[model samples]
Target: MGIDYRGLRDPNAEYTMRDLAAESMGVTADRGGGRDVEITDVQTTMVDGNFPWTLVRVYTDAGIVGTGEAYWGAGAPELIERMAPFLVGENPLDIDRLTEHLIQRMSGEGSIGGVTVTAISGIEIALHDITGKILEVPAYQLLGGKYRDAVRVYCDCHTETEGGAGPPDGKPTGEDPPAADPIAVAEEAERVVSDLGYDALKFDLDVPSGHEKDRANRHLRNAEIAHKKAIVEAVTEAVGHRADVAFDCHWSFSGDSAKRLARALEQYDVWWLEDPVPPENHDVQREVTRSTSTPIAAGENVYRTHGQRRLLEEGAVDIVAPDLPKVGGMRETVKIADLADLYYVPVAMHNVSSPVATVASVHVGAAISNALAVEFHSYELDWWDDLVSETVIEEGYIEVPEQPGLGVTLDMDAVEAHMVEGEELFDEV
Candidate 1:
């Protein structure tokens, strides 16, 4: 005799007798809980944003679809296609198990850390969206609820005169040299802070200083250090206490030079110096962090929790900046934040994705207690928020959605208008 699922229903349980009857008949009831919904298909498309925004969609038998994005890269969409078969017929709610399965199954393809993991990260985020919608809760609630109603956002501003040149042979053109004007940088910073209302801002500090003799050696000359210092001073002085200012080096300097640059900005109330040295060597990164009073931030290049272990364990970074779409998805980023919190480090997400991943990152930032801010890299992209149905950021902050799943709907028209050339659109469900 088969056990009756109807008898298992409790008076206070969410599902009613009618819902249980539907489940016994293999029908999906209201709120998607009656019957098991399997993954029917996975699709991908690219949006030509600041980067090629790789968008993913996971379809279910119940007709519910979940959307996500991978960090912009060449191979992510293809890798998602390669992994789709394994997810077919599996329950989307089993997110952790499926993520681990993909990590192990694709271990040979460098899933331990790189494009493969980025692909899996995209799928994992889609799963969370599905699970949250089915469970009738917001995505941050699926990640263990939220700590705040809104997440602070930091804008990335570019100065008018910040430009450099390189030759076709991969050599520095030396002709253009770095011409980051302190005055122009300050003007832009003031406009973004005062006019745009961003309390946190970042400026690029890794441009040609017009004083480099050997660019490949990754050494900063005294003149180069002075030039960078001037820009930092001008921006910080321009913003004053109204906004906190950070600078990014893009990991383009050697250890000694990175330390020198960090020391030069110590006198100012700098937010942090980002990715001062290469990510491959944690010891050198740690040495640079310990060398100066200015806080050092990194980790956008790293992949999963294991990839971020040494950086937090050895105090390599004073602030952790994980790109959610790139760093093993949402849950993994929260785990990384929990690990950082144990060591008293804060999180600042490094983001350059579309409003899709930006909203996804906001949910993660809302869930984590130690979150500092989420980076907004597309302020210049006039149509960045048009890709979604709702306004993502307002007054330099993202309000956490109370609606189930990601809450924001993709504007198909905007997506079609900005779709990357030659890429196929998602099939109509």
Candidate 2:
């Protein structure tokens, strides 16, 4: 004797028939009137390009799927697979619980930082994508709504025509390419600012300018420092006040050398000097920041909030640049930003993945008032926007979409065309 469906729909009741039907027909638990949406499977693939792009897909019982990407590196796919078993059967909407569960479960596997955390970040972002879709709201809403309609973007311009060549291991190509050398870099910066409308840009300053810097000890010769200064001078002169410029050393200098370089570049009114020295020692970075009037940015290689918290609390850096997808997905990044906000520190996201991760970072930057800017690493990749259904960047800003989830779908043709050697698109194990 099953209950009669016809009698269950009382016209006088507060809830609608569709809502009641959704609950009685498919809802898994009594926690809410919504469907449970349990995780069914997780999949990953590596696509080669400037760097290997590690993409993750999470499937649920309700037939909804969420996509995300991890930072390019070895063993992240394997790490995601290792963490997938714990996520199976859990509610996709229980994002915080699930994120903490994965982190706690992988604590033994060195989840404190490195590849393990990166793998979790991919899954965590996918969970946000899933949650946003299930709730029928934009991802920014889950982060407590947005502070701005569009997120400001900063281009990572280089002096090279990278897009004209054949795809590197089948990675996507770009439209117009920018080229190297101080003069060439300055020209490219002017073109990107005036033509592309990018108001902010960064360049790699570690390349030797016909001067030998001790590579082994990370020591800069006087000539090397002067040459680097010359490049900055040329770029600053080119852009004038149209754009804010920052130079990246990629942790290529010793503390003494980094201090020397930072002081020399202060005259250019640079945005910030990035990762001039190794980030392992906070005291060293603090000393460098204290010694320079120019702002110091670091922490892209650091892991989670715990990893970056010390740097902020101890006054180690003026700008905190955490690689969102690699550090800890959306929610964690928001938490990281909030923590930094308390210390009066501005967040500048360090990005190097595909559109999936880049847009994810945009949603995060939109939610946090302390976010200064998000990095655009694929300016020269002509097909960078083709990987997604539509272009997200217009002019120099990423317009936040009002659509549910991440607001973009993967272009399967583009993805499959650039899939890494011997990989499949979310193929089940």
Candidate 3:
């Protein structure tokens, strides 16, 4: 006997697009966060995704890309094992279901940090990538249609400087150097401006102007007022009025610290003060906003709009930056954008990693109505796009091709060549 149509036969239809999406993709599981999920594979490949220490790509027979973002020092493969069974045969396209399942695994601890999200973010990206390929459209189209064609790129070229001077000569602190004085940064900014013929630079404000100056004021001692102001003064002075320079504070500040620094550095004509005082402390962020004229922006550390709505509603920032990969890949980032749109808050997709993320951010940048800019640290790194199937940056702008999926296919050969120690295709993470 066939099943009865309980309410459908009543002739009163109550359904929305969400029901359709849910029905199409369907929800089958809602596992909690972190578990003893063991790894079948420990794949590690270095692309442009954040710091290149190799990423663990956990896969299933379903052909999903669970790109695990293992932190600087943390084991993730083991967690993957505890969660794998709950996900086996579960539909990858059903993002809502997957999110719920992952949330469940997150358990009573109120959720986990790097491992849980990294696993979720990876699976989400693979599923979306598959969906884009299936639909013969880019992932952004799935998130929403294109809102802009080209994404603006901000060169994150870093260099060392001394005492409010300019970028120093010689190799950049040997490929990647620890923090340097403000003068070293200024000289490097000049080189990019004059020699490289580029504008839009990104500088991390961490070095203090001087020890004496810092010790003179308790407020400026650690992650201080002097350091930020010094970096800003040097970079802007060297780049002049022509270039767009953004300071990435990396969420290393207290409310008072950011406010004091923002107020002092306002003269540098900062394009934006980013991730100041962490993603939490929205109240402190609001206080900072109230105190300074600089347009405060934060979100790289933020996940989806679910948590972001609070910060946006509170008017804590002028710009919202959702790191595409970090916030459950592309779709969630778009969801973040939609919410940001309602609040009249402009969004800027954060592309912290390689081409997969960059391509996804491109689509979001193109489709988001209130998108202001797209972040990029890729161009600054060595052979940043070498692993990508396709990448193009022209005149400080990146254009997304109207191709299927993300318009990118990871160079598997290259990935394999650099795969960490013992991961094989069927290694089973």
Candidate 4:
């Protein structure tokens, strides 16, 4: 192929920018077994799950379609639609180059962070799926191959009345909901371990403690800390060594309060304390992590590897939990893992997406050497696994798919049944 260098600078360039850039990078048509394929269209649909799951599909001229899920947000679907024109006619096999092209092209839309990157992340993931299918390999193989056949999952458990332990009439019955009582919480934890066969679980500690005078200050009262500690003690005692219990604070406390809470939980064999302080201040996060023997996990709020680099460099967290879809797709997450590995920090993917993105996280968990566990956030949602053809997580682990691309096919019937109110299903291929 002859290079037309002036076309690259032309405003009315006939060649797509991606093709020009690929040629400039010496990416030949012979790459990925010389197969020629071009992206035809990109489509998105929202499935209302625990969080609204934004599903993305990239269609090709060859009739092969790749499916992916973006981290849900208000403008994600619109952003993906706007980006579709940039991807059309580009080879799906040049995954990295094309991902960067999208990022650079959409920088005005905040590609460095937020919904723009989330949308691009979905497109990047679909490219991986399509490329893997084109090469007749699993998605994990495209991400530097797998280190494990199955990825262990940690369930994010919740009580029946988590937000408020009150009755339907807003009347305080004599009986409080299980979420408010330590024994009830412990009993639920025991049930999840004994019956569900999960070895790892996470519960929220940022629940209403009833001792708060002001929540905007992010300060936790002594009674609040004591109540949280009681829950931790009870649950840890109930589960014992059968399962590792982690507590999530969701970045809801002050540095002093988080330090106190961490100190209180040091008696038990807690798995980790997640996001004790706001993620913006790395120094505060580092101080909190260094103050306690309990493992500290953070990073779900940030964007690409750049957003996570400071946390790792400053030893802010023991575990780095980057949501694959929210963070910059699979390859960017691999880069994050590689950086965390340098500091010996384990990668525990913070996932709240549907089976599509959950399976995508499993592929990433398989590829990275520092993977600890991928989160299963939808255990309470009965129809979560039904979104896909095969069961995504079985016995608390997702068996790395040996089939091409993401392996499991979407069950369109289930998706159509659960589609968001205003969204339309993907057109038939």
Candidate 5:
């Protein structure tokens, strides 16, 4: 049987941009669909646990729906709900246009780099999912084909036993009680590497309880720095040549102190030193990066490509870790990676969401040549992958799906089972 390319155009007869722009743009009928898939409704729900997981779903007139998750936050669901009206009648396939429209529409709402962008990011991801499903392609293809089939994943792990002791909120903690000291941290690293098969891993280096100095001053006492170094040294030494280890300071130190800490940890040969200093001042970050042999990675808290562009253009950090769902979704993430590519920088996705966003990051990770690895923060949460129909990540890599959209349908049962108290699933729509 011969291939019927036109059969692949938007199945809905109610829409037809194909006649005008399809052939001229070299958009084969199979790949030119979804442009007419109009948004019918937008809805959000929250899941209670470590953080309030804000999930976004964009329903289209074509019966195709896309799901995305805003990075965990207080106003994410409300923010998405507020922006839903603007998106109601627009085309989910006009991803870039819709993204800009939302940005412009909410400009006065303080969307520069906060919950506003997170809301937009969730919506943007859903749009890509819709467009991909409509066109029968993967989300990465929408970003321009792919460079790799499997994206490496890094776990944001910890060694602390209890709350207020480990990586803190927004990061995962498990029932496997925390180990005692640096030795325990090493044991955790060994288990993660040997048992879990994750070649790259990260742990927090600046947990308050681990250090002795005052948190307000941004200055690190010698003992505090030494304690931080001990953690790094133990983890790296334990994993020795088996896995690459990274440490996160979470923007806890002053520039000078951060540099000193970075310089001190140089002997450990860490994979990357993350957010040693705060992210506000690029010059200071750049100075810290230049001062240390350990690679500096930052920008997870940054909102969109614009924020990352500033850091990349200034050579602020060695590696940029954009939280894909939080950093303006798939397209913006690809844009950020492309911009970083020009500067010969690599991208390490800062992920903390469930499988929906994990797979979304996999798509972006597949498309970018310099993508180092994507974070997997749900190792301890057994139900994390249950939220989706199938497990998207196994071992330490995501096998990019050829199936359309984000390639995973929401297991509503799993979602409902985890819903936050007093929250209804997509009830607003």
Candidate 6:
């Protein structure tokens, strides 16, 4: 515990130097984008319900390739295809320049809902990756400098809950449904914390596993609190000591209900109460923070600093979780965190998807001073890492790869193998 900072991994791990990358830099410029690169191919997949992901592989007139994920929902393909005219022959690496251009292009476009921004996010990420590769620095260095050598992780463990993150591929092989009973949940938390080396365990305490509708069974407000308390007791007894316990209200409880529930659950030593009130009410958030000794956290649905200004300024919660993809790109997210850090609030990113997003998130988390942890949900996804070929993460930490760029190489073959049928851009757009 005595700042074991001396003598760690070799700082000079052999990698192609920046000069080497610069020498070979624009190799992809042949396929480079500006406003001229055509979005020749777009692939989309629904990785279970609500887990839709899309990969936009922009092919430049120069014949180089850059990939990005505009995935949030089914809208990814449409967004990419719709913006095709603008992106087809353009430079994918000029993210800021292009974003500025595209913002006007997309202005007055649509609601900029789950789809449009997701598309923009995909393009930004790919450009960043390409730029990183060109520079030969791990993406983290480009975003200033890394704050930590490795990122700490926490598991939502919702996959095991009844309706946790959706039914497990609907092919029940007797997996026992992720220990929904509080005692069993506590046991699982203990295993993940004591054994798995996770610093935090955030249980889905808002509703019973598998049933969103069952939350109504509580009948009265007191019953709801009692039910929540019982669930907390079951797991708190199981997680035992040391590991932090937190609850994600999932925006289920209103302001009053949220504060009441936070107070009730405090006895079990909850670490932070998350998203209890909806993201809209700043005053509600302030009230919740003032009402409870248990810390508060939110901002997953919050966007760029423009979106996060009021919440962070008001000191609404103890921690802030920016959905790296959902929020604006890395630069904007860093700005949001800087504002929060001024208030001494920390960050815990919300990433519960495939490895692509995970790797991008790791770079940002590694670079930020106030980052608490990167949400490690998909490490349990068996074939997940096989999709991306890189050593971006190791053991319980995100190992900053010596490789240039985002440090993640997509195994196209693996992606093709898992490619859901009929997803190939068989037709135009």
Better of 5 and 6 by TM-score: 5
Query: What TM-score does model 4 achieve against the real structure?
Result: 0.92
- List TM-scores for all candidates, in order: 0.91, 0.87, 0.75, 0.92, 0.87, 0.79
Q: How much lDDT does candidate 6 score? A: 0.65
Top candidate by lDDT = 1
Deviation from native of the Cα of residue 185 in model 2, angstroms: 1.4
What tens digits encode model 4's per-residue C-alpha lDDT throughout 81-111? 9888777766798889788888988889989
Model 2, range 1-429, lDDT digits (tens) per residue? Answer: 323232222334556453555467665323233456678888998877678999999998788899899888999999998887777656788788778778887889998899988999999889988989999998999999999999999999887621222222333344222323678778998999999999999988877454542356677889878878888998999999999998898887889999999999888879999999988989999999999998999989899999998899999999999998899889889999999999999999999989999999999998999998899998888888888897799999999878898887888878888889999876532
Query: Ranking under TM-score, best-scoring first?
Result: 4, 1, 2, 5, 6, 3
TM-score, model 2 to reference: 0.87
Model 4 accuracy (lDDT, Cα): 0.87
Go through the candidates in order and give each one's C-alpha lDDT: 0.88, 0.84, 0.61, 0.87, 0.82, 0.65
Segments in model 4 whose C-alpha atoms lie over 4 Å from true places: 1-34, 164-179
For candidate 1, list the clashing residue pairs, or say none: 178-208
After superposition on all CA atoms, how large is the RMSD of candidate 3? 9.0
Give the alpha carbon lDDT tens digit for every residue of 1-429 in model 3.
Answer: 322221121112344333344445554222112221222232444432346433445454434344433222244445544555555434445556666566566554244344566555655665555556555777677776786788777777665343232122312232333346777888888887776555677777644344323221224454457666777887888878878888887676667777887888777689888877866667887788768888888877765566687778888878887776566556667788888888898886666666565666777788778877676675555565666567666666778767766677566666665545565533332
For model 6 the local lDDT of residue 269 reads: 74
Per-candidate Cα RMSD to the true structure, in Å, reads: 6.4, 9.1, 9.0, 4.1, 7.2, 11.3
Better lDDT candidate (3, 5): 5
Off by over 4 Å in 1: 1-35, 165-174
Query: Candidates 2 and 6: which is better by TM-score?
Result: 2
lDDT per residue for candidate 6 within 246-280, as digits (tens), equals 77877766677788888887676777878987787
- Candidate 4, run of 10 with poorest lDDT: 3-12
Clashes of 3: 45
